[model samples]
Target: MNKLNVLFLTLSSMENINERGIYTDLVRELASRGIYIHVVFPRERRLGLPTELEIIDNIKLLKVKTGNITETRFIEKGISTLTIENQYLKAVKKYFGNINFDLIIYSTPPITFERVIQYLKKKHQSKTYLILKDIFPQNAVDIDILKNNSFIWKYFRNKEKHLYEVSDMIGCMTKGNVQYILNHNPYIDRNKVEVFPNSIEPIDRNNISIINNEIKEKFQIPAHLTLFIYGGNLGKPQGIDFLIRVAENFYKIENSYLLIVGSGTEYETIKNYIDSRHPKNVNLIKSLPKKEYDQLLRSADVGLIFLDKRFTIPNFPSRLTSYFEYSLPVLAATDKHTDLKNILIESNSGFWCESGDLDSFIHLAKSLADNNVLRKQMGLKGRDYLEDNYDIRKTANIIMKHL
Candidate 1:
């Protein structure tokens, strides 16, 4: 049987590891299935090359230099003066002209790449898959980042429509996302859309053990305290201010700690809040290496997930995988419609509260902290649910059928 030549297009933070991005695991999974995976990413700062190529684990990585742009500022709402679309096009023409792919899978947020996908499909006769991670223009409108009936709305909406039109298949992360796409854009071909949730390779529990004491000592986590960790991006979508309020409400409680172990635009805001208030129970740390973070997850009593209530799309954070991997119970606070709430409630993983409800959040936190048996049961249930529903091997099989 001939292996499929898969070209994956996305903006990845790194190529080699699965620390903070989506493409790494997707690449690894596809590679494991005998797919010839190639990645194209914008050049990293301090490394000046308009186009460079490297191979890792039988996969090709083509790094294209767009003008040097700081991702930090871009992530914080700073617009890129340099046109990434032109740069990406030039890179594809220059570096990837020799290769023909069976399928082109494009992930989006910077939905400006629809033109590139169209070009690829025209040039190579390859099927285009839109890995719909986030609903951009609609999400912007939902969050008030882009106003309805405004120029910005019109501009992004057109771009989004172009993307949907270009994709042969649209792979959404959740059923709600698929419904959102179909309902909002009634013109889109309904048969082309499908749900493919985020997945990870299951952890080998035999080889992994909770390093409770070491993690506690390193982070100054109290031996007696039950640690609740929020371990991912701290940004507008997460409603970090609500987390601060949760911390404040529970500051006086004994044997309970809140540790946030990631960075984002709101990192400084969260840090400043912690410093100004001097909450003895809350600790803020920059993102750590995956092994260390995973160990922390294994040791922690509860995993925390939060999202802004106003988000237009029902987001299923990939961070929940770490929690399930380590058999840690979750306390997710978000909009009622999110699939996370459904999974949590159905699996008996933990509790859910309204996004900004400090009172209910604190109440659940305190209850979980006090009840060891309940926490253990919830954790076991979550681990079992992940094994049944979210193993990467299972998801890979589904993808194989599509291919």
Candidate 2:
């Protein structure tokens, strides 16, 4: 059989060989399955890439420069809009103009790429897949980041609809997301929308165990303490304020520690709280390399997931893969309807608590810490679940069947 040529478009800042991003993992999985993948990503200021293209394994990676402006302040939001739009247009013209693909799969956060997809579909007669990773305008509305009836909402909503209309198929990360899309746009074909959950490559426990002791020592994690590690974005969507509160409540627990290992908008806030409180059990670290993070996760006693209660659509955090890969039982704190809660309970791999319930969260953590046998049993269940469900080879086969 002739392998399909896939062109993946994403607005992510950078791609490292082992670091997991949706586009990065998908391209690698596809390449490993004999499909040829060419990826084009935005070359933002923070991302340093070679001028000449590079190939990793069998996949080609091309970085096109974007606007140099940094929008960290409230006043810069308007400037960011103009800057990003211009940069995306320039990137499309410079890098994507010459390429023709059998299929184009684009991930979204910034919906400005709708125009690019529309152009690609007409030019190449390709099937376009809109991998809806984030519900943008709606998420903004849910969090009061944007008013539902405001001009910004109306403008972006139109763009959102157009992006949906141009795509041949829409792949959502959860069933709730698929339903949300369908409910919002009743005219969209039900058959064209489907759930494609995040997946991970299997890890060899022997290889992981080799670095386990070193990772724990490097982090200054005590051998006797139960480490509950949260290893992803520290952002508003994570309800990091709630996490900080939980940390404050449990600061005195000698047998337990909360190790937070990532950076985002809320990093400074959490750092400040830790400094002021001087919590011996709460440790904050910047994001580490993927291998380091994976090793630490493997060594840790438990993995944590947190999502803001404000999020209406089910957010299945991609970080769950690391926990499952290492057979580390999860402690998911999110809204009531999240898809992750169901997965955790069904797999018997972890426990879930309502977001912002500090009392319940603390109790759950204490239970996990006190009951070593139960924790080990749950971890084993998660390992078995990952082997049966999230193996990259098996997931790639399912994706190829769709193609």
Scored by CA lDDT, what does every candidate get?
0.80, 0.77
Q: Against the correct fold, how does model 2 do in TM-score?
A: 0.92
Candidate 1 has what TM-score? 0.93
TM-scores, all models, native as reference: 0.93, 0.92
lDDT of 1 by residue, 52-101 (tens): 78887758888876644442664333243236777778787887788888
Worst 10 residues of 2 by lDDT: 69-78
Q: Write the per-residue lDDT of candidate 2 for residues 293-373, one digit (tens) a residue.
A: 877887788899998888887777888878887878899889876778888989999999999998888888888888889
Which residue pairs clash in candidate 2? none
The true-structure Cα RMSD of candidate 1 reads 2.2
Candidate that would win on lDDT: 1
